[model samples]
Target: MGEADRIITLPAKLATALHGIAPGLITDTLAFANRFLPDPGGIGEQQMDGKNSETYLSNSLLARLTDEAAEANNEIG
Candidate 1:
């Protein structure tokens, strides 16, 4: 898979794995933005407005990590 695919797909995969290991442990918020983002290419700047505090915070962190991972993938590949 490509870098963008990896970035978008990882979180949901991880969440599913976690849920499998421990049923009812994962929240839907943990899987947010995994299937789609309003602005995939500019994930960092995309407004996460209207989301609840917890969901917003979770998505913010996910966006940060996705950007970091994408950068590293670009640097290495």
Candidate 2:
């Protein structure tokens, strides 16, 4: 999953933290997500282009820091 996807699936506490730091970011990510679509076909389904998002995220310092923190937390656990 991409950074946005990871953020979206975060626990409620983490989600709240993210919301406190950056208002509406989760909402924007959900808006771009392609799940729960009535029209799975080529009809009006707004899909977030994974390639573009991945590229953008790869260049994001915040994403890198978050990934490192998650890895460190996993190691501790």
Candidate 3:
């Protein structure tokens, strides 16, 4: 079968557990981001604001990583 046609079922108990924890996990992660990486939309904004060489490098690396991930996803999907 094609990947797109594949179906996998998860246990109902596991699905319920995931649903219960997902919101708080997401909220805590966002709270961490807000605590550490505050006031900047993304790498592009930080780079645009003349943050530092580190930010420029990070932006470039993130762009390359994003491109690579897209290519890999296209290959898989």
Candidate 4:
């Protein structure tokens, strides 16, 4: 399994940490997570070319980080 595959399968906490660090590297290494990590919402059905794949992965990482930040805020507030 590739780094992207590992990230997708890992628990959210660990995944968040791994994703937060060296995201650019992950983006560079990605070979389309759709092959292994099927999006339950059917978002992965579309073909992911190189540029699209990078954007999608980056957006996904950002979304996960945002979610974690929101959760942290809730805990603190």
Q: Which candidate has the top score in TM-score? A: 2
Better of 2 and 4 by lDDT: 2
lDDT of 1 by residue, 1-77 (tens): 75345545777777666776876445565456455753343346666643322345556866788658768888423
- Across 1-77, the per-residue lDDT of candidate 2 in tens digits comes to 64455454458658778877987888887777846543443434677664334544476885788668768888423
* lDDT against true structure, model 2: 0.64
What TM-score does candidate 1 get on C-alpha atoms?
0.24
Tell me the whole-model lDDT of each prediction, alpha carbons only: 0.57, 0.64, 0.58, 0.60
Error of 1 at 53 (Å): 20
RMSD to native, candidate 3: 10.2
Q: Which ten residues in a row have the lowest lDDT in candidate 3?
A: 45-54
Better of 2 and 3 by TM-score: 2
- Per-residue accuracy of model 3 over 1-77 as CA lDDT, tens digit each: 75423435556455445656796875676688788764545465434533233445556865677658768888424
Minimal lDDT window, size 10, model 1: 49-58
**lDDT-better candidate, 1 vs 2:** 2
Local accuracy of candidate 4 as per-residue lDDT tens digits, 1-77: 65555555457657567668978766655655545764444355665554334346556866677658768888424
Superior by TM-score: candidate 3 or candidate 4:
4
